[model samples]
Target: MEMSEIQAARLLLGGDGRAGQAASRQVGQESASVRYGEVKSVDAEAGTMTVLLDGQSQEITLTDSTASTRLKAGDRVKIVKQGQSWVIDLAGGISRALDTAVSEANARMGAHDETMAQQQAAIEAAQAELAGMDRKISDAVDTAISQLETPDGGNHIYAGADEPTPPKDGLKAGDLWYQTNASGQIAAVKVWNGTVWNGYDMVANSILVAGSVGSTLIADGAVTTAKITAKAITADQIAANTITGAEIRADSVDVNEIASGDIYCKRLTATDGAGYTEMTGNKLEMLDSGSRSLVAIWVEGGVCYINANLAEKISIGTNSGSVLNISNGGFIFSSMMPGFRVNGVSAVESFAIAPGSATESFSANVPYSPHKTSYAVVYYRCTYTDTAGSVKFPITEGGSANVVLKELTAFEAADESIALGCAENITVALGNSPNKTFAITRGNPYRFAIKPSGNSVNANPGSQFEITQVTLCGQ
Candidate 1:
């Protein structure tokens, strides 16, 4: 049967339900009885309950008590019969006492969770520190490897036909023993002995220049004749002033090898037809095709001779436009060309001409000197106007008799130098003369004649004229 609050409270409070009280229970079969059973149903109004006892349902009355505890179906209890009163031992009554222990266990579990979170954060920080250490170690290893690379940053074998420029300042121990050229052949091995490269130098003269290939470095006389090829050493490969007369071996210089450039030796003999040059006992000669001397310098005469065609002109001085030019003019100057005056003055004041068919003339002596020049110039100032032709000079001069003139057709015009029309204060120059040259003397007179035009009429002693500055100018 279901236990009531009064019975449960009594069982829990040990009200006639303890083993001590069981001593007071009657031991006889009909005196008192006790049984263990599960309640199947309860009826609160009837104060009765149905319980399973020994696998059978039994109806039992619930006893009331001052305790307020209650029980329902499914309650496990031990029922005790003492005369007419009943006592119950309830299982629910024991479970109520364990609540405090369960609460304490829950609080401990929460504290453990908080400790785990703190440990996790600390582990992450340790991992970050380890990563930074890894980077530092990696940097240290890289620096060590770089130091192990070379004395300089790079001291490997050099390449290319040109030379190499090794670093000047670097670690001092390791030296560059040799370097290769652009042809991939190892040239003269230069050993850099911590301080300098051992070799022959020209500019510095103590150590090798950066142009370190194709030169000797071991010592003097180290290079044998077998190392040299025929005509291998040209002029450009030798440094200036380094190869002197004392070091030169006899007949070592092949004249054919000097294709161009001047060679200043005491004597040089070249082969025939090879831009020939030879120094003999008396003269130094330069040849053209082979035997013909283009130029020669003779020690006996102390004169430099030029043998060429007459068309060649000798030029002197080096300036832009101003220079002494010696050309083959038809009128050659012997010593000097002094000036000559027509009438001992620069001008002839008055000149007169006669009437038609009769000509007035002027004449002067040559003074037995060079009285004519290469140029012909004439000028006149007019004081008269007449139909007479201009005063004219003979085209050919200088003879005791009639002057020898070439064919008349050689001159197509009366005078190409002067204009036909006359004007006051006019001047004319025959600077562009013909190629023919002439001599001048008193034998042939100037005449200075003027003839009137054909079919023209004129007055007597007509139109007296003025001739000013009739000079044969020098070219």
Candidate 2:
């Protein structure tokens, strides 16, 4: 039974009902108790409640039911007595309590559902916005790629072409096309410089100098920028220093010029075919093919005169002589025909036999048996005369009249003394004589007599003597 507070309060305070005594003193504790099964209809206006117990319903009075003393269905009512009418029940007590709980639970569920719906809508909106932005970004990328044109008539992409397909010419997506020299080598790179397309450095490869593998020659390029030089130029030096040794070897230099030490060729022969003197300064001159004269000179005369000009100097000794004869004994002779003499006295000397013409053949073995048998040998000696005058001697056969000196003995003994016997001090000396002297008379028969002088003089002119043959006896 549901009971109103007014009815229960009247029962407890006034002791007006049968159950009043039972409920009265119990009020000092907390709320009064009611039997749930005994509840009947609540009467909110009468402030009392009826309850059924033991199959019978009754009206029980209560002291107070709360302020206005009204009750209704759904209110939580209580029966404070054993017999209480439905009017004494609390007003709408059970119903009101159950409604409040149901309302509160519905409100919370509604709030949670509303909040979850909002979150879902927000997520959907964000996804749609992101999809639209992706489309715009993709459109911008396409515009950028279309603006660029590669050398092979293709577009350029940042990372790569769409779908990463190779270019139509099988080139990389961002790659440019250019011509190469059949070696599959990159001739040059034509790339974009942010504003325009331009070619990077393009240069022709170099060739080695002929016959020189390590040497190099550039066909064309700016030497200052191309970095060309001789082998002596180190790699680091080439990079650091200015480029030099820049030349085009169209034709070789003259061999004569090279042989004469006029020009230098680094990697060419000294006698190159193009007349080039492949002479190089501070470097070696090498042949293109065969061997060559490394350090040689070409002489043009009949004799190769390397040192000073001693053309007419004779090599005279006790065993050798000059090729030509001088007028006087003490002189140096030459080999030229009708030769000349240097540093010789030529006052009155005559040829052994008159020359083939004015020129005498001082060649070997063309005269009478000469004391100096060799054509080159002749004797030299000085003489002192007691008369203090010059002497004269004839290089002829010694005889009284018609005489023939077959040997040296005949020539020595055939000396006819037609002069006075002056003295041993009165001497007749012999100078360089190619042929043996048959007769010699120093003085005239009317003056001082002749004498034999043992003094000696050099026949070779410069400090030497020569004897071709030895003759012991005078004819």
User: Cα miss at 356, model 1 (Å)?
Assistant: 40
Question: lDDT per model, in order?
Answer: 0.41, 0.37
How many steric overlaps does candidate 2 have?
80
Model 1 per-residue lDDT tens digits across residues 221-282: 24323234365465534434234343456545443344436556654445544567778877
Off by over 4 Å in 2: 1-82, 85-99, 146-155, 158-475
Per-candidate TM-score against the hidden true structure: 0.20, 0.19
lDDT of 2 by residue, 326-346 (tens): 332433332323332222423
TM-score of 2: 0.19
True-vs-predicted CA distance for residue 278, candidate 1, Å: 4.3
lDDT of 2 at 11: 50
